[model samples]
Target chain A: MTSFNAALVRADTPQLTRVINGYPITYLDSGATSLPPRAVIEAMSRHYELHHANVHRSVFQTASEATEAYEGARLAIAKFINAPGGAEEIVFTKNCTESFNLLARSWGRVNLKQGDVVLLSEMEHHANIVPWFQLRDMLGFEVRFIPVTDDFRLDLSNIDELMKGVKLLSVTGMSNVLGTINPIKELSAIAHKHGALIAVDAAQSVAHSVTDVKDLDVDFMCFSAHKMLGPTGIGIFWTRKEILRDMPPFLGGGGMIADVSVDGYTPANGPTRFEAGTPPIAEAAGLGAAVTYLTGLGMANIAQHEHDLTGDALTRLELEFSGRIRVIGPRDMTNRGGVISIDVDGVHPHDVAQMLDQFGVCVRPGHHCAKPLMKRFGLNATARISYGPYSLVRDTDMLLEALHSAIGMFG
Target chain B: MAGLEDLYKEIIMDHYRSPRNRGELPTPPAVCTEGFNPLCGDQITVYIDVTDGVLKDIKITGQGCSISQSSSSLMSAAVKGKSLEQVQETIGTFKQLMTGHETALEDGGEPEKVDIRALGELAALQGVVKFPVRIKCAVLAWNTLSQALSELPS
Candidate 1:
């Protein structure tokens, strides 16, 4: 507990010191986008200041340095997730959304055809659902969902029937709205038993836990850098090198083509086949720095600190608010991450969020881009308070204080 | 408490807790349209029975924050007994207050304050205009009303 110093992490983040609404900034919206640490900021800035050039094709010195930095980031990310294929398997895209698009447009479009089923959990983010549906629209494949239980956990009772004819089992590792962490290895095992390739939407889980792709035995994994204390405009898509090598290129452009002629063009091999244009070089540097920063703090510590905080907050909120506000996510800390979604009786999420904002406690209020899950819960929206590695118990105290004020004002 | 009171004026809360004119009007002849804010999932359905050029009856129903629900309640109260033209005028004044315009002015130029007195308790929502985020909440019902009126037999 002493080793997990949120104060030190807070010090590394420059945004934590600022004042908002005459109150110290209590950021509880990390589920949307995490605040950047000085390490990430400086790495990106340093890249622009010193090493700035196009990647892959450049032969010059700065170009080679940039290429190395970019490749080094791939290595770092691959290692971070403990990917078996290492750097060769990691493909950088615009964000997690683009990564899913690549998987659906390239792999799903090529491998899946009519009657092929794609199994998705009901609680998946739109990033995991929409791309497959977009492909399903044209391909005529059946998209089935594993319904969520009333207690906010995935229902697997009918999973065997649901996985029939399923070509791909694409699901979120952790729900962005519910914070329920799915058992990835077990799900992968089930998907494999059903002869379906599994893809993990690691957008929420990758930042919160130890993500070992090899251990989980997942075929494909995608996550956004911004959610993991890195820069935006960069995301990671990981798969085994052999599978990625054979898949047709998603976007055909300069960097993605090995040979181009007036009559025809040949797409490059490996992950580069997917990366279309000049990659996010500076962002790669920021991601690399973020990797180093997280590595230094140790992901296990970050996970533990946030878990304790979440357990504490849930206890306090339930005890204090009691009948006023009900938690939408798992009440137990086990199998759940740091996301806390709550429904205030007789109050809208927008009102709750606005009242919280008056006290400089930022929390996201909406469907959280999971409309199906919202409809599943019969909820329009819920006020979500998410924690980052830098978040502390004090943030939770301020959130509760704001909650009391908001409830009192309405009463 | 100080900051919150400005936003959730007592009158606003009263109207929110018990919104007036909330329900589906009988059947046809009464035009109804729904306004939805996709960002926060706030939705409002405005139902109006316009006989000839006058609003014989109007109802505002939806689910959302206090500002939107209360604004809908007050809006239904204000426009229920007014002619079509008068309802349009009230809509313009509410929009001006929310967007900070000159619908408050009488004839000559006075202060830039909103015409809260004319709008009645509806003017209590003027505090929302300061919060750029909540501006849409205050005007969602009014927008739905306009949409509903647009479809009214002309």
Candidate 2:
């Protein structure tokens, strides 16, 4: 048994109370998004009830309060990720997809040219892959993929050769489908050795592990609030202050500009240069509370908690299902998270997900926005069950119960 | 609150388990068109061999859930021996059945009830509308079939 009491954490999540289809909701889709705790909801509601106003502009008291709430969230997020450049390095976007788009459009266009190469992995979600491909089409830069090994690890054996002519190495810190925890610290060193900048998509790993940007030494990192017990509509794009200062602003609008006229305008300094229009102020308040909640839980404890759950679940799944089920990710617990994608013999993933839904067990069934990886494995889709800090062993027990029924039904 | 039985009717499951006309035909003689539900990565390739305005043969080759695969099987069985005009009528009625109330609402009138009797065995898939997300899975092969018919050498 793990030291961390996930049932206690689950009690604070209001969504856990709901009963679906005559059964309690067994939410196992945290890889897609996490459920916000009561603290996050209350903080958001409090912002709307007491201090609701537009941020950064008005001289009035409420506006300042709103600005403080918004900026305070940035500070909390910066501290959460241990960003060396502090809040100045954090640029808010719509979500992790927008963050990657900002990185590709702003930094990519300026730095990369015809002969340059961008190295991405086959395991990357479409969010990380599509933006660079979109940029590569316009910039005429070559894009290469680091192949995935048969055992579901990044084939870094040819890393040195693949890194040649690669100006940027972009990869996910943890695969949403496979739950493979990448070696970001080592990859960062390899990228630097090849004179290429590295970007880590921490969208999946941010909530499950401790992400210190300083220790990783990654040039860029991106994550979303919704996947980390926070509200939707807000995400973070973090880079060093030096790189952020040099890169041009992505979206052109009122808040992003330093000075404007009929002629071309100069962009503002710091993170605000990229944040145009009204930002997600209410969402930011929720995110701030979420950060505080996660900090209180202690990230190390959450990591260990998930690690224990994953090990137990993997062992049970193999023992119970045997030949009927095949895990699509690494069997070993080392460098793995709580994501478990499985392919049931003779049953489609969608069908499995549909049956699980009958038991009120929420699991995602699809390619998981990682079609390249799916193609690599010769699979159309997989039924993926992921975990959050609130997830418990009983959840996996319910999952096993549901899977037994699903397979029996299909049979 | 429709149960799993409603979505996966006995006849539908039978068709899914042992799909009819499950392989592909030669491309030169049989025109092939593909449809994809990108959301779930469900793909279908529809091949049809039409002669003298009659669909002599219809085959389905794809990978998807029961809803999609079974719907294709049902569709192939229904249209394989029909004239082009009859096949077009069946397609119209099936699409109407799938659309349910949306078509009637668009015309600003009473909810035009789908006549299930007219749909024959295809009516077994009517429960798919209760779950909106699965509707795409049911219609993917039909869309590809329609595309193939439209592109037929006229």
Candidate 3:
């Protein structure tokens, strides 16, 4: 197995070399979107330079090459998640948000009905929650939330009770705001026990953990490529082959059909039915290279590295800013990733983030698109500092330094 | 390019630390309007007591960044006892201040001609124009106050 070295990873990422203000950039916002390495960028550039053509529509050499690259990306992503049905299960969308929308509009329209319950969690990002809510508005389904405990974990104490009428249990694999890595396997078991199919929003967890959809026993998984060291404009929604076959098309136009007539159109077989019009060919190439790069470095090693960084940073943040800064997420390293949300006393997150910016530390400040979770915690916003595979201890050190400066300025 | 000091002036921080006229002023007697910046979750509520075509009393309430809260506080102090026409002028000036002269001209107004001295301490928030995103935070209070004024029973 190749050893995971953050310095080597940083060297490969062109963004890491950037300087902000007068200081070297300390990027700790990877939970929002990860920095792509040179390999991913070069792969995309190469595709655009050489083989820029629409896939599946043309028989030309360049078009075929583009199709091969695009299909190869789907296979790589399928393998990355250990999808049981492989490439046939992977459907590319605009982003993770679109993936959830596709799942809700297509699968939900078919299966869910009036009085059917769709269970979600309070800590879920808006992408996972809003689509279901929108669909519920139309289909007249009841949407219930799994409460978050005071300790920043999903309150599974009443999971069995919550899953009663829950035809579908959709939750985040890891919270974007809380950095709480949820027990997907355990939840999947409970969901099945309650006769509910489970879908996971793996936008945060997939990059920081080794995702095996088979092992997790989840029926559906949605994640964005941008958050997982890939490019934007491409995301994956993976499900079992039987489920994909049964689910209807989400966006209906071009490329997604076998035959189109004046009367009606028959949807294409497999994942292509969901992918309408020209796909993100260059982005698919970038995602393919990202998959290769992550695989080469080893996901296990990256996970461990991020775990150590998170644990250390959490501990240091607690010790140093004991009364000043309160961590909004789980303090324990167990079942957590590198996303750290902190609320500084007597300081708004926007002000704190602005202060940190002066020190060249990039942190995200806001509700993190988790309004329900923010309300649950009675917090408008928190300044979140997240880590990536390329992050190092120095990044945390920079964050701490910036935090001290911010507090000093705001205090 | 502007530094932190430019955004968080001493007067602005003072207003944020000790916000003036902060509390509810009874909705029946005072019209309360809430302004929200969905981008950052910064919110401000403005309560205006209009007495015979004059804004007699104004109170600011809500939670937000320093710029927002301070802008609300400064705005409350500025327009507390002003005539309706004067309050309208203040709102227009503050909005122009946040958006800058380019937008003012784009809206078919005069050039960059907002009198800085007329804004008084509100001019402290002028630096917000440098950081485009925070302009919303600075103007949220003004927008809410404008709403409150419009809602005043004529």
CA lDDT scores, all candidates in order? 0.90, 0.94, 0.92
Pick by lDDT: which candidate is best? 2
Expressed as tens digits, the lDDT of each residue in B1-154 for candidate 2 is 7799989999999999999999989987889999999999999999999999999999899999999999999999989989999999999888877775665545665545577787889989988876768989999888999999999998
lDDT tens digits, residues B1-154, model 1? 2366778888998999888998988658788899998888888888889887899998777788888889899899999989989999999998877775433333333336765679888878877755667878888999899988888766
- Cα lDDT tens digits, model 3, B57-146, are 988879999999999999999998899999999998888777756566456654464577999999898878777778889888988887
The CA lDDT at A156 in model 1 is 94
**Candidate 2 local lDDT, A1-411, one digit each (tens):** 224568989999999988989999999999999999999999999999999999998999989999999999999999999999899999999999999999999999999999999999999999999999999999999999999999999999999999999999999999999999999999999999999999999999999998899999999999999999999999999999999999998998989988998988999999999999999999999999999999888888999999999999999999999999999999989999989999999899999999999999999999999999999999999999999999999899999999999999889
DockQ scores of the candidates? 0.56, 0.87, 0.82
Better of 1 and 3 by lDDT: 3
Candidate 2 runs further than 4 Å off: A1-4, B102-113
lDDT of 1: 0.90
Model 1, span A133-199: residue lDDT tens: 8999999999999999998999999889899999999999999999899998999999999999999
Cα lDDT, model 3, residue A122: 95
Weakest 10 consecutive residues, lDDT, candidate 1 chain B?
A: B102-111
